[model samples]
Target: MSESFNQEQNPSEEKFTSSFPPKPIVEEKSQNALRRSLISLAIYALMFYFLFDRNIVYIAAILLVLIIHEMGHFLFMKLFNYSNVKIFIIPLLGAFTSGKKQQVSQWQLSLIILAGPLPGIIIGCLLFWLNKDLKNETIEMLYSSFLVINLLNCLPFFPLDGGRLIETLFFKENYIIRLVFGIISIIVLLFLFAYLNPILLIVPVIIGLELYNENKHQKIREYLKHEKINYHVDYVNLPDKDYWLIRDCLIFSFPKKYNLLTPGKYEYAIVEPIVIQQINAVLQVNLNPDLNLFKRVLMVLFYIGIFVGPILLFLLNR
Candidate 1:
């Protein structure tokens, strides 16, 4: 009994380490906000001229739906004490809220992303029910459009609330995974669109190509930034295991001025590289994700939704 107890105690007492550090909570300015808002305003204006100008009453109705959808994001973020929330409406696409980097857990992110569509869908259903008495083709078309748009937006595709929600659900390992999934999504979109309207297939293809190229550039940039390491200090104390967290926080805090450079050498200066061979150097790091059956199940369901939703929509509608 004493030997068994000693063996268990020794194993438990052994030190453990990790290869990667905890990622810091980053709160960078959301470029999505300004761009989304401007685009939304432009779309709304165009839509007003084309669709709603004929019937002012419809404008108010659509606005109400958009408000409800955006409010879902705003309210939840606010509830969780997130900052810098703003909402804007895109004509056919629906509304979006940007700003507020909630270092959200997987569940929180899933819920937040899911929140936008639920309200819009529910409201649309209610409108369809309440406005059933009205027989006007325009109003009926408008009601159906709202319902369709809301449901379609729930399809997992990037930049869309649903896509973001799906990403959150699986806690995408990295941006590359997202790009790959985005490509798959585009292929599926193209196939679905081919029957209904071949011309529309171009849309997803274009989006996918653009995203892929952009991500490629981003990866190159990150590699260039981290490739060559230079230490200014005389003594190099190895980074703590939680260095990534610190790095991310610093990056957010100083987006414009977060590069390694000497003060006097603005023109650029090259230095000789020093090589040191050490067989066993201690490095610090954090814990790996503790994934289990439940998380795996959720991931499977999320991906299934991604691959199947668009195909189902197209087939059912067709």
Candidate 2:
């Protein structure tokens, strides 16, 4: 009887073990992430050394300002519960903070964009106040650099904080508009380089290369549409009014082919269907508050202040 009981118990134990597998190795993933971060740091150090002409003091100062700007973005991303937040240094260009969000609203996007530059602007203002009495050249230079960096960051150009804000707020998924804007940005950069510093022609050249690459990708996507391919459709249960906003947000956050399904007039209930192909993934958009007139007015005023404030302060002090 004891032998029979042991035999039955062993099979049950084996079945239970088979049903529940072990958890994933968290440490391995963490170690891989650490390794990548170290590599990035090494690259940034090398680039900075060459870019700054080995001026440690200047490098330190620029790094401090860049870190502070990126920290603002990082903190806000964390606040919004975004995943995999990381700040990358782009040598001569600038530092950028990136994170993943399943669904983001227009207001949230605007706030995140503003977060990077707003803190720097505030610090610039404080530096201006401090330099008022002392008249220190170092303080003046720091203040000027801080203000210029942050203010220029707010410009509505692609990849810039200001450009991102405009894209989220107005352009949405309109590729044509974006392409036009990109061309305009390149032209403006060329003119600025010609007027300000001819040596800065490298910036426009880089922009042109990037634009060319983007256009090539766009053509590929267009060609894919004409080919016969297996596609998946996802129907999202959302109101008609919320369709475009959610569609824009999804496309902006996660780039993919998306088509909006229109319901018949006889259909009483609205179920927004999104047809997706090439990627097998389902996304649900969360409803978020819309931007109002009051907020719009405030944003405009804030932008005006940041742009003119530094120049005005310098003139007044001089």
Candidate 3:
């Protein structure tokens, strides 16, 4: 994806920025923040020890690979001028990079998703090649683990790098489609674990928890949609990719728009018409509703290949 943004500013940018009310700021004590950080580090260290059976070398190698993977994501986010870029390590599962994006294109999103895994995959390949001659058990183990971790991270499951790519490429504007895919992904993972490694049921359990959280948030949005109140319309110039995020924020944070001047006693609306109109204009500029059948088929095949290819190779080698 092209990294460059259009230099020309929209004429409405000033008007848009001026219309919205300022967001409230929350203050936090530095000491409190420092204490929380220390606690989190302690927990992470304990988890790392338990996870790797106190193998210092293994822990160091794993952390290195994970940091590289996250750096790939962070770099791209920085390139795109995303705010508050940070990587959080989830003791057992993996690391995730998050940032605040005002707007992003689909291709830009794809680049970010691939960034999280591609660098690690490349480094893993290089390590595997270098260790091919020496055949040192530790180096070989690290090489294999690196490759396997990255490949697995590309699976078509929610909260994974591959799943994020799939969502951007295929489910772009449709919340329902993404939700349904998330559910199906959980089911597929459950069956795969049952057949291959029941001990890995934790994978699906984590995904299930993610889905539950999303559902809970969705319910809150639904409630907000029906609440009776009025809101002044604020125009913001946003890209097509950001429409959904902004819409979701509006759904959860504000009451239904009633009237321009006063709160309508009975009328209810999810958002003001002007807001929808602006969003639609942005959508019209970039929306591609249909993914071709051939590409869709290829994506499905790619998903299957990533999930099954490694297992087949391992068995064949054995």
Candidate 4:
């Protein structure tokens, strides 16, 4: 079903023509993405410095730990042939590695999740035991910081690596169950904000935005499915008509979010980039997730062991 980029618009935006396959407005090279990643990481570090008011040593150590943690996920994603993999450091929050893939393996996805925190936790525990007697203040702080951040990430809170592992293994296909888990994550995170640093409340705020975005994407996907619009393909392969169609859907979905935008207009808007970003987000490869119950059970045990193994090792060494 071929359609004009602006099927509903007047004889305007003539330059915007639908082609056989779509082209991205800007080419997002891995090198450029990596450079942006570095810039963002620098910004995150500076923000962390101002937020914590800790000794420079603590800030440096925390930054190093986050880099290592995200690298663990990044490297594994590369190993699994994930495209567009990049680490994003969220200011005053945390870091995450993002990539795109159409047919994801459940086992590999589980490894990618574990890969982030497990190694950092293990290394931190090792450093702690090795320095128990020496007690160098920097090493002590570094290891403690590593344990705290990575261990918190291991918690089954949505958007965290551990929560993602659980969601992927069990509720990946279960929308109702996933929604319930998301609500629980929100409540728990609110409690955490009341207990921990209020600045960290930005995390819950981001999670709320994520939930809103997810709902919008879900609705878009359902509508597309009803209209028999193909979207299972990766980003680059998305047709121009489909892109415009999704953009209209997004504008309709978030009118207030993207104020002053009308659906079905082909005129390029100031928020085109953001709208394109959402289209990319809404387009996903159907997860292969070739995981059976037995494999999933084993993955769960492995997930638990990531937390328990380090503690067991530290206790035994102590």
Candidate 5:
């Protein structure tokens, strides 16, 4: 047990600005992100090649589609001035682009979520139209893969592009609603896994664990709210005192993960990084509710329209 907060040394005493830390650190982290991304993509390709389809064209087509889809999200995130943008390939579960913004604009997030699937869908439609005469198998797989994958992503389920859009527009921070939605989504995914690939069962399992963790930490968020601790700021902008205080809360909230560490004394342990990661997870992104009911409805209709466009094109081309 330590007495009053130490004025001796800040835990994040390293050189940092409000928005960014030191350049070398940023560069190292960026490199690590890229390395991890490439490794994941490689694993995805290998797994696809071995387990599911040995057809290199199909594998390449699928990989190309996923990368393009994720890049759309990545590009939009960058355009929105999000920090630390990264696209991660999750083997069987496809890829997702993650970035950090202290104050997230609801409109921007909705656009970013749509940005992933919309581009692929458009390209697929164009290819479908152009390849009317050219019976190319590679073109066939490319367009079909893009259409199927991107359209499925647009299905309104939690964590999927469309689901994320709905959640961003409607279910922000409403944990009980998200809990119900997430459970339904998991059930749907489990059915998908059963039908398509048993290995895909891992996707729902991972999502379930995340949903559980978030619900588990809800109490701590409430406590912080009661204590008037602000968590809307980015991790870099987090005050040293607040960080320690949150660490204390986290220890109590999650004793298993922090069992080796203590609350008060700032003795840097091996698990400090893990604790920081958890802290970041719990930190809320302030979503600006800029969209009115009409606008939100319009966005939903636009998403629906994208799906409709393909159906109409198929019917007309036939």
Candidate 6:
């Protein structure tokens, strides 16, 4: 934690800038490799203290798997020009890299998202292939953990790599398609929760609930489509002031014929039916103001887990 803080504070840290979005933010620079070294040393010291000193080798193996998995996303995201990357190892849940929220095409997003779990699966397979004998317990355990974690990450649930793939690859332009996806995800999770451990159950429940709540607004949105665009949300209310509404949106509009939008596609039109000589257009939307309390609550809980729940898990599982 100290090292993480120092990385943020280090004045000489490398920075990347961008101009497409006006504010060129740091794209993806690891602050002082020395800070990372210190953090790794600290984590090792702590893990060694807790997981039996002799288990240091196993812990290190786990860290290696995690780093490779996260680097998959980090590397690919950089290749695609996602700036200001911050890769952090999150215990229990694995790792992730966050960067500038760039507007991406569906294909690009799919590739970026698929990059994370593919590497994990590849590495797990490689490990299994290398030790077909499976005589060493440490290698066996590592192999199993990697396979389990990677497979679980493969499940389609948002914010998860698989979910991102679905959003990017199989994404449909219609609200009905997304609604179907949400419903199917819930049904699959119901059966999954029944067969899985309680600890794993929470993950799907949280994700499913979020999907359901988000989809609940779909009906209202569809109903409003027949009407002219009159709805809009004040950006000031957003946690991130620059946030834009995704799915079932109207990017731009004209008086009689509003241009409709789908998840990752754009729809644009000239305001006049015979505007061969002149053009003037504006975007209008009937923003649904209804908040999904359940999703909001679950999101808060998920964030709490990200920050504090892992520490509790370490203690309980220790």
Error of 1 at 209 (Å): 6.1
- Cα deviation in Å at residue 205, candidate 6? 3.2
What TM-score fits each model? 0.53, 0.64, 0.61, 0.87, 0.89, 0.49
Report the lDDT tens digits of candidate 6 across residue range 1-318. Answer: 112113342212233111112111222236764366448546754754575554666667767766777778888778878656767654333457775432454545555666776676656656666666656777767776676666677667555666555544444345567667766776676677668644445666766666554453343333334332222322222222112122112222111333332222222234213221111111122322232556445533543343243245335544
lDDT order, best first, reads 5, 4, 2, 3, 1, 6
Which ranges of candidate 6 are over 4 A from the true structure?
A: 1-59, 88-91, 156-159, 212-318
Highest lDDT: give the candidate number: 5
lDDT of 4 by residue, 16-135 (tens): 344424434756687877788888878887887776676677778888999999999999999999977888877767778898888888889888999999889988888888888897
C-alpha local distance difference test of each model:
0.52, 0.60, 0.59, 0.79, 0.81, 0.48
TM-score: which is higher, 4 or 5?
5
Candidate 2 segments whose C-alpha is farther than 4 A from its true place: 1-54, 193-206, 213-289
Please write out the lDDT profile of model 2 over residues 132-247, one tens digit for every residue.
89989778778777787888788777667887777666665566898888888878878866786576677778878767645543443333233221112222233332223222
lDDT score, candidate 3, position 87: 69
| Model 4 spans with C-alpha error above 4 angstroms | 1-24, 29-31
Clashing pairs in 6: 18-24, 26-84, 27-83, 27-84, 27-85, 28-84, 231-285, 231-286, 231-287
TM-score of 1: 0.53
**Whole-model alpha-carbon lDDT for candidate 4:** 0.79
lDDT of 1 at 185: 76
Candidate 2 lDDT (Cα, whole model)? 0.60
Candidate 3 lDDT, tens digit per residue, 194-293?
A: 7865656788888787666455444433332333211111223433323333343333323343223121111224444544543332232243434466
Which candidate do you rate higher for TM-score, 1 or 5?
Answer: 5
Query: Candidate 6: global Cα-lDDT?
Result: 0.48
lDDT of 3: 0.59
Q: What is the C-alpha RMSD, rounded to one decimal, of candidate 5?
A: 6.0
Residue-level lDDT of model 5, residues 1-318, one tens digit each, is: 121122332222332112332211112288888999999999999998988757888888899999999999999999999988998888867888989888899999999999999999999999999888897877887899999999989988877888898899898868889889999999998898789878878888999999877865676676666567788777887776677767766776666877897655555667777877888887888889999999999998998998899999999998
Consecutive 10-residue window with the lowest summed lDDT within model 6 = 276-285
